[model samples]
Every structure is written in C-alpha cells, then in structure tokens.
Target: MNYLKEYNELTAICPKTYIKYSEPMENHTFIQTGGIADIYIKPKHINDVQKIIRYAKMNEIPLTVLGFGTNVIIRDKGIRGIVMNLEYLNDITVNENEIIAGCGASIIDVSRTALKHSLSGLEFACGIPGSVGGALVMNAGAYGGEISYVLKNAKAITLSGDILVLNESEFEFGYRKSIFQKENYIILEATFQLINSDPAEIREKMDTFTALREEKQPLEYPSCGSVFKRPPNHFAGKLISDSGLQGTRVGGAEVSKKHAGFIVNVNHATSTDYLMLIQHVKETVKQNFDINLETEVKIIGEE
Candidate 1:
C-alpha cells in the first residue's frame, strides 16, 4: 500500500488532524515503551474520527483505537495500519445531575468535573489515570465504585462508521469487562448519572481516595497500572506479594516493590520485558496458589 497516498488523503479528510507516519508508540503510551505505529492520528473533532473510520474501512486498512495508553502494553514489534489516539477528543460538560465526557477525557479529569459540579458518584474514579474510553472498556472502578454504577449511556462509532448510542443496559458491564471489549466499536463519549451533593463533601471523598492511592500505589515510575485482574476472592496484588514476586525483574521491568500489582519500567524497559515479567508472575502465582491470574491491561500489536 502507498502509505504516503493514504496519509495525504486522511489529511484532506481532516486537515486539522495531527497525523504522523511511522510514529513511535513509546511516545504515546504511559509506560513509555513499545514499537512504532505505521500511521498515527490524533483527530481534533468527532466528525474527523467518523471520516477517518470510513476512509480506513473503504480502503480496507486496519484501524486501532487508543485512549490515553495508561492500561495497555503494545508489543515491541509494534502495530501495523492506523493507530488513532483519541486524546484530542477530550471534552467534559455537566448537565443538571449528569456529566457528559468525551471518550478521550481523563478519568481523573472527569471525576474532577463531577466535583466541580458538586455531583456525587464519580468520587471513586478521582485517581484513575486512564481515559474515559478506557474506563468504559474495562468498567474501571475503585474504592467500592465502578463505571457500571454511574454510566447512563455512551456514544460510539461502528467499524463501518455508523454511529450508536448504547444505554447502560446495553453495556453489559462485568468485572473489568464491557461490550466494547467484545465488539468492534469505538467509544466516542459517555453520559454519567450522578447526584447533587455538597461540594465540600465531594471534595473530601475525592481527597480521601486520592490520598489512599498515593499512599498505596507506585506513582513514582512509569508502569502500566495493575497488570492483572482481581482473581475470584483474591486480590492480585496481595497474591503477588504473598508469592514474593515483588521487585522481581525482567530487564528493566520489575514487579513494583511499592505496589505488587504494578510492573514498573524503572530502567527503559521494553515491551518484551513487561510481557515476560507478566508471564513469570502468572506462572509463579499459578504454581504457588493454583489461581490462574488473568491480565487486566490490554496487550496489543505484533510480537
């Protein structure tokens, strides 16, 4: 395929879209690791996203949707085709007791928006670092709250460029799983149902949660947050700590000594290092506890 020709066409479709050829994924991901993406785009408008999606489908080009890259690990060999980073789509607004956030809006920012509006329900997400899209994909939660508890509906685009509005019932939310994970749909925005609360009370809750995160989580280094899902009746971090896997290293990737759930990139780690360490953690935990740990973070791209 003539990538230059495709790039020019995409630019034409969305002249203001930030487009790059042979873009480095390492620069985009929070882990600061991964190989290159063939074509990278950060579309500024929702219309641009639709147009790009249609163009890719018409051209039979593969497209990958990306959020803030907080809970994902791209392989070292990198991804082929188009990688669309939705960061530029971030927009947050409040209406009555509801908040509408663009898919690319930071979950933390969304929670803050809730607070600004004196809205309750998103206090649990005050410290989550992923984008709204990522949170919806994983049904992300913390401190006794999850996305399913508050999400009313979401706007999305099909792979074929058709738009959709999925209500909460249609979300099919589970433990860190949502329909978006099973379907070829790109989340565009979300509406969250919340309740009016005292701003001071909401801020207090947010402060408490944020403080707990800082005290318990490893925030010093770059890492994909929480490598594995919570096993039934067991916490992944607790299990890893019990199995004595913390501080275990594969190259620069080490199971965080601070938080056993995280594998930190302490020394310019490659995706291979992260994956190997993850595999090691899973194997050791399975051997010791007979609990098969499933990864929570999304791993994509070639080997």
Candidate 2:
C-alpha cells in the first residue's frame, strides 16, 4: 500500500492537521511494542476527523483509530493505511450532575474532573488507563462498576462520515462489548450522568481504588492490562494460576507473577514475544480447565 501517496493527498486536502509517515507504533502503545504505522495523523478538531474518515472511505484506504493505547497489542509488522489518533481532542467539561469528555481525554482525567466537581459514579474509572473513546468502545469497567451504568450518551462518526448520537440503550453496552465495536463507529465524545457527592468522599473512594489497583496489578511494567476476559463463574487469573502458568516467560514477556490475569513485559519484550506468551497461556488454560479463555485485549496491525 502506498500510504505516502494517500498521506500526501490527505495533507494537501487538510494541511492544518499533523501527519507523519511510517511512525513507530511502539511509542504510541502502552506496551511499547509493535512496528510502524504507515500513516499516523492527529486531527485537531472534530471537522478534521470527519474529513479524514470521509477521505479514507472515499479512497478505500484502511483507517484505524487509536486512543491512549492501553488495551491493545499492535503486531510486529505494524499497521497499514491511516492511523487516526484522538490525543489532540482532549477537551472535557463538567456541568451539574454531568460530565462531558472528548474521545482523547484520559479516563483518569475524567475521573479527576468528576471528583473535583463531587461526582460519585466515575470513581470506578479513576485508575483505568485508557481514553474516553476506548472506554466507551469496550464499556470498560472496574471495581464493580462500568461505563454503561453512568453513560448518558455518546457522539460518534459513522463509517460514511455521518455523525450520530447514541444513548446508553443504543450503545448496547455489555461486559467488554458495545455497538461501537460492532458497527465500526468512531466515538467522538461522551456524556456521563453522575450523582452529586462530597468532594472529600469522592476523592477518598478514588484514592482507595487507586491504591488497591497499584497493590494488586503489575503496573510496574509495560502491559496491555488484563490479557483475558473473565470466564463464566471464574476469574482468568485464578485459572492461569491453577494451571501453574504464573511467571511463565516467552521471550521478554511473562505472565505476571503479581497478577496472573496480566501479561507484562518483564524486560524489553517484542510484540512477537507478547503474542507467543498470550497464545501459550490460552492454550494451557484451555487444556487444563476445559475453558476456552477469550482475550479482552484488542490485537491489531500486522504480524
């Protein structure tokens, strides 16, 4: 694919935006793995995003949206076509009993904004190291709460460049799934309804959750967070631990000893190492427990 030609044409059409060719995906991902993106572009505004999507669709070029890169693994051969990053769209606002956040805004930043305004429901997302777009797409949750519980509505761009607003019901949010995933919608911003509470109380709850995550998770290393989704009536971690796969290494990647649910880069792990370790864990767990563990982390790009 001649991504350079597409990028050149795209730049000629939208010169105000930042565009790069053959940008390293390693720097964009939380795991610090992967190869390069054929074309990486950061749209400064919603209009810019719309134009890019329209252009990609019109030219039949593949387009991928990247958030904060918390819950995905890009392959070693990199991504093709255009990689649209929403990092520049980090705008947020808090009104009474509601919070509005752009796609690029960090979930932690949203949680902090909510806390500052004494909003209670967002306390669960205080430590989720993903962007609003990623959180909405996955219905991301933690500490017994989820985005579906608090989400009021979301604005998204359809594959054809038409903008649409979807309510909670329209989003069809389930555990680790949403309509955004099914329909290939690009999330723009989300509005969440939260309860009014005392700032001190909200901060205390967020602090507690943050502390617990730090104590339990292998946050010390680069990782794609939880590698597998929770199996029916059982946690993925317990399954891996029961299979004696804790601390198992494939190249520089290891099943985290601290949290068997996570596969962390203990050293300088490549994307290949991570993929191999993930496959090994899935196969081992399935053989031992007769449970086909599904990955919660999104794998993208090329091998």
lDDT of 1 by residue, 1-303 (tens): 447788888878888889999898999888999998888999988888989999999999989999989999999999888999998888999899999999999999999988888899999999999999999999999999999999999999999889999996699889988898889679999999999999999999999998999998989999889999999899999999999998999999999999999999999999999999999999999999999999999999986
Cα lDDT tens digits for candidate 2, 1-303: 777788899898789999999999999999999899999999999998999999999999989999988999999999999999998888999888999999999999999999888788999999999999999999999999999999999999998999999986698888899999999999999999999999999988899999999999999999999989988899999999999999999999999999999999888899999999889988998899899999999999975
* Least accurate 10 contiguous residues by lDDT in model 2: 1-10
Error of 2 at 165 (Å): 0.7
List runs of model 1 lying over 4 Å from the truth. Answer: none
Question: Which residue pairs collide in model 2, if any?
Answer: none
Which candidate comes out best when scored by TM-score? 2
Predictions in order: lDDT: 0.92, 0.93
Candidate 2 stretches greater than 4 Å from native: none
Minimal lDDT window, size 10, model 1: 1-10
TM-score of 1: 0.97
- What lDDT does candidate 1 reach at residue 299? 98
